[model samples]
Target: MRGAILPADSDQAVLAGRLDLGEGPTPVLIRGGMVEDVSAAAPTVSDLLERDDPAAVRGRPLFAAAELADRGPLLAPVDLQAIKACGVTFAVSAIERVIEEAARGDMDAAAAVRGRLEARVGAGIRSVVPGTPEAASLKAALVEDGMWSQYLEVAIGPDAEVFTKTAVLASVGWGAEIGVRSDSGWNNPEPEIVLVTNSKGRIAGAALGNDVNLRDFEGRSALLLGKAKDNNASCAIGPFIRLFDDGFTMDDVRAAELDLVIEGPEGYRLDGHSSMVQISRDPEELVRQARSEHHYPDGFALFLGTLFAPVQDRDEPGRGFTHKVGDVVTISTPKLGTLVNRVTTSDRAPAWTFGIGALMRNLAERGLLDIGGGAGDGHD
Candidate 1:
């Protein structure tokens, strides 16, 4: 399972992630298939990424990557970093959001609304670049046709919708249970590429993430976004963060393609795909918008919105897909590896008790809080 979750090119990809060795989250590096405890280099991932070259930093040898399944459970690969996400960045997702809105969160109504909405404006939304005159014109046309939507506004408007996803230390890692709201009748996993950045907003690395969402909550009212998104163990990020190096860079991210598979307990199977190339807004552009007015002192992980939105009927024909308990969701891309998690209700999932305060206390007790050195200071 450890090897399955690692990047296909694990030997070449420079990776950084966290592991719980009984006490607390420990920063580690996976280079040349070996996992090295980098606590001395940096106590937290936020601090590790602050370095000019995180891949070059070295530390005590822990175990081989293959031995990860026997080690402590892997963490979300981030600590002290803000979790943020962009929405409506892909045409298909944008259209889906509009359908969610138009249907007013009713699962039965969504199918009908989806067909009408797609027939009306899908091509126009797909062709125009966001924040362009063409997009504005499309917006005007939609409005005239009584089809203007807030989702469409963000989809084509100059401003991207960047919002907080979850609290620090709240996201689960690979093989953990990802949660959906207990009462949510309509929800699905959003498989996306999460950009890891420093305080300066420089994208340092990328990881696979499942932005677990409740369509009904958000569809009923955009005001319910907080309730729809932030739930216990709702966000899933990791196995590891693939740090950008000579062999891997932002260009690779731009061309990256993601594949999603959800295997239900009742033998239900759903497969989806998302290509970064089809995104309406560029990854760098989304980052710029995220950093426009706010500041993430501890850095942040930005979820690049997905192109895949499940519209397949799970049970009844008109009712669309929704997660059932015990569903095993796998989001994978060759370069980033796989993020596999089982489905559970938010209330039933393990509670998130380890927070920023807990992390500080743990680091202090470990005598790792006093280390002070920049990028090149600690290395082999």
Candidate 2:
């Protein structure tokens, strides 16, 4: 993990090439390390935001810590596509890659990959613990974990940033947050993940919602953290994933302003703008520290947050937008000035359907409670 020592003063910003381990976005902005933002200015990434029309608000709501710090408040409306336009190269190294291997069903190989990703995200590559066959199998299924469109519920709230990073995280566009999932039909309900957002097109805070996810629908069994991880944390929730280190505490997150709202037509809406009130685990630290604690199974809890903004149908098209996923469901919006979200395929069959609030109630019945904004096993 030998990196160039960047004093607290020198200033420059640009993306890195190849797999700059111990040097990519995660470490550069490590809760403890002063950022060495070598990334270029916004112009490069902004120019590629496909839909630049003054009217299109549909684009990706993405920006690393450096990008957020450099850019002004993320209060403007943006769609998913526009956000993903900024293509930067960050390799999936060591333990990160290892986990992907395990998630793919290769226990032995996955154990190897775990050794690597865990090392990279954690303190060092040399300390990764071996993965068990069971852990590896779980990883395999976990890798293919796609957000369910027909089975999701919305915990309408003021903040939850990850919703904004749909494309990057769950590989889907938005969620059943507002009811209309990317592949939902009137008959079937979509309760992929419980989400929260602001009515305006901004996410400067973390949106919290517990998991009502069911492993076997109808309150039979609850989806554990592994099953719900992809559903829950699929992106970076910020303009506010603060860098905390020695002496820093939840009090700082409490001080940060997180604007959230839910607006569409005139009458139906919900909004809550909260100052984070508290944030204790700095993700960067958790990830890195995991490297140190890899030996202990489930010993470390890693969280990756982001703002959520899905494509919704509102008078004409709402400026807010998202990158559609499914091949069957197509949504129209006036915010981005066009059909901002939709399924790309020609399939029209109602393969899956979901309901509102039912998913949450069912999960609770099965012992799956939304532990804050994440899933629960009743542990810490």
Candidate 3:
């Protein structure tokens, strides 16, 4: 998994991430195939990214990057960063969300609704830009035809759908288990590119993410979004964050193509693809919307919503896709490498005991808090 998780051009890539060194979460950098503990320069990933040149920060070498998996489990490459996500940022995802609402969380009924809805509005939604006069006209027409949906409103409406996905220190990293609600009958994984931003909302780096979805809960009522989204071990991010450099820039993120593969314990396999080029809202636009009337003092990780929405029947015809326990889900892109995790019920997944308080106490105990006090400030 370690070999698979590194970028294709890792030797030239500027990477930042975190690892469990038994004492606590330690910020590290993977450069030239070596893992260097950067805690001496910056105590947390959040602090490291606050540097003008986070990739340039040096540290003590711990081990070769090849032994990453054996050294210790990789923690989410973030500390104290808020976890936020955008919804229905792709035409296909918007349509699938409408189907989810129409079916009222019933996977068996989705096929018929999907067919009818796609036939009526798919092309129109795909062509219109959000928050435009053209989008307004489309909304009017859909409402007149008695087909208007809240999901559609957010999809093409003036404001994008940005919501909090989980909390700080709640996200799991590579080779960990991702959770889905046990009772959720309709669900799937959302493969996305997560933008790591600093306190001032500056884009520091990018990483792969799995925004695990519980369609049943959210489809029943959008108000249940919190319950549907925030669950124990439901969010998975990392392997490592590729800090922006001349070698990789926002243009690379704009043209990224993500691939997802789910291997079920019962011999079921599903392959899916999502292209950033197909996204309705540009990554920058989404970030602008997120920063509106908000402040992330510890910075934030924003999930640029996915385009892939699984409609293929897994068990029975017309039943649609849903995760089963022990399914290994892999989300990958060449530049960002890969993020892999096993699926399990929220109740069954390991509890999230380490929170901000635990983190602060641990860092204090290790004398990390004073090592790099305000090291990365007034830079970039």
Model 1 per-residue lDDT tens digits across residues 1-380: 33387888989998999998777788999988798999987899999999888988988998899888666457999888899999989999999999999999999999889889999998999999999999999999999999999999999999999889999889999889999999999999999999999887889999999999999999999999999999999999998999998888999999999999999999999999999999998999899889887767778899999999999999999898999999999999999999989999999999889888888888899898965543334321
lDDT of each: 0.91, 0.23, 0.91
What lDDT score is found at residue 76 in candidate 3? 94
RMSD in Å for all candidates: 3.1, 22.3, 2.0
- Model 1 spans > 4 angstroms off: 1-3, 371-380
Q: Which residue pairs clash within candidate 3?
A: 52-380
TM-score ranking, high to low:
3, 1, 2
Residues 276-299 of candidate 3 have per-residue lDDT tens digits of 999999999999899888778788
Model 1 scores a TM of 0.96
Better structure of 1 and 2 per TM-score:
1
RMSD of 2: 22.3
Candidate 3: Cα lDDT at 127: 98
Candidate no. 3 TM-score: 0.97
Candidate 1 contains a number of clashing pairs equal to: 0
